[model samples]
Target: MIDEVMFMRHGRTAFNLQRRLQGQIDIPLDIVGQWQVDMSGFTLAQRFYWAKVSNIARHPDRLSQPSDPPIRRSDITEYEQAPASRRRMVVVSSDLFRAQQTAHAFADPLGLDVTLDSRLRERDFGQWEGMSREEINERYPEGYASWKAHEGGEAAYGVESRPDLGKRGSSTIRSYCDDPQYMDEPTTLFVVSHGSWIAATIGNLMGLPDSQLDNLTGMRNAFWSRMEPQYTSNSVLFHLTEYDKGPDVADAVDWENGPAYLRNPDMPMWKPLI
Candidate 1:
């Protein structure tokens, strides 16, 4: 029975800035990306006490009522002074550079080490790897249209199929849930991964419908979603603290002269709803 799980999408990168398909190219985070992660770390440090302190330390008075509020440090300096009082935090990152960097931002603040997992890598884009939407449309018009229409299934050229990608996402998530260490108690696991993989994983865990699958894309760079596990006999269930629905919106029209969602879609509907 895992307690809380947080899925963090890596910060922006050069490819992201250009609106290009990075796939697994191992792009590093840009300056803005780094700043975004720093703020996230700062925010987390404020809310909960780090795990360095025992669970007992978090609840000094064992008899404290459930209505008792969490014991949070008044200042950052005070929080850092008592290393023993810090809460325990485990960071897991995709092998990709962007994700690793984002994980580092959170791990460094808590004085924790990051565990890299290849299983968390992004969906391989294959031939569409470094191309932007326009380029992909121009070069592989037929494949692009088919991919969008199906939401996913046919790989762009020789890339990984949507069904396979979704399965990989589901399996990776299940692996963490089934791990004895994470299930030992109420643990918080910060999984730093790609947007596509995150979306697919959430959809897989919740068994979302095809039409609703695209709703998961509202996860902006460096943002995160909190999830909790609900175990059942036949399957593992999860509940998201929050998920963004509706089409992606931009402040202004994109260079494509259309809404961001219409211009560049991001959905992982490899198979029709069952």
Candidate 2:
């Protein structure tokens, strides 16, 4: 059975709308970001039914292990089929307002509660916390220069280095994924973190170094990716990956700001849960 833990990027943030760093800052979602969450919720909800049915068929007998679920059939629903559903997918995010807000979009569809993890927080930018990229470039040119190049173990504005951020991000994932309860489920984990942390964690997972930071931010929000198994929970990360830019949907805020599913008129509280 494929129970994949997935991530959904929160829509544009107030900082994003304003083009600010937003590092470790608390900011809510903009109109477009709210829309992204609704869309992610719908996509995941639709995909959930089929994935559930397939898992029941493939892993007819419970394996009792957390390793990747093997493919029982190849000619299924193409790539988004059998093997995909075998892994338990969990959606998580950095504690930043934007990241948690974005994470809710995915959890909404799965009927799961998100854990607002602080260790998953974006790199603490210290002095550069709220400045826009342009402001940094025009104001603190030297620090910006070092920031864009020199990394990790060296403090930039007391900001976290690439390695430090990577370590933290990885640590957060390991802390939970290693938990007996979570691993027993064999989930495909999704983390809704920010650009800098995303870059470092993904970069290190893919074996790219500081020179490849540019490749990390290029990934779009509401987008999804995957990684091959790393053998152990601590080391297994973003290996073989897949990304979807996400679908389009009507803009909905009252639904996006918090758990509207609990109050959705068409939804019966005990129906899905029971």
Give the root-mean-square deviation of each candidate in angstroms.
10.0, 11.9
Q: Write the per-residue lDDT of candidate 1 for residues 159-205, one digit (tens) a residue.
A: 77655666798788788778876655556777889888888788877
Q: What is the model-wide C-alpha lDDT for candidate 1?
A: 0.69
Q: Write the per-residue lDDT of candidate 2 for residues 1-274, one digit (tens) a residue.
A: 1134344555666566556777777888766567666677677667664434444345544323345668354343443355655455555677778888777766654445576777777778877778877788788787777666653322646777777677676666556655677655465566787666665666665667656654565345555555544455335544645554455432333322324533446432211111
Which residue segments of model 2 deviate by more than 4 Å?
1-5, 50-89, 149-154, 232-238, 248-274
Q: lDDT (0-100) at residue 52 of candidate 2?
A: 44
lDDT of each: 0.69, 0.59
Best by TM-score: 1
Write down the TM-score for model 2: 0.67
Kindly report which residue stretches of model 1 are placed more than 4 angstroms away from their true locations once superposed. Answer: 52-88, 151-156, 210-212, 244-274
Deviation from native of the Cα of residue 267 in model 1, angstroms: 29
Residue 8 miss distance in model 2 (angstroms): 3.2
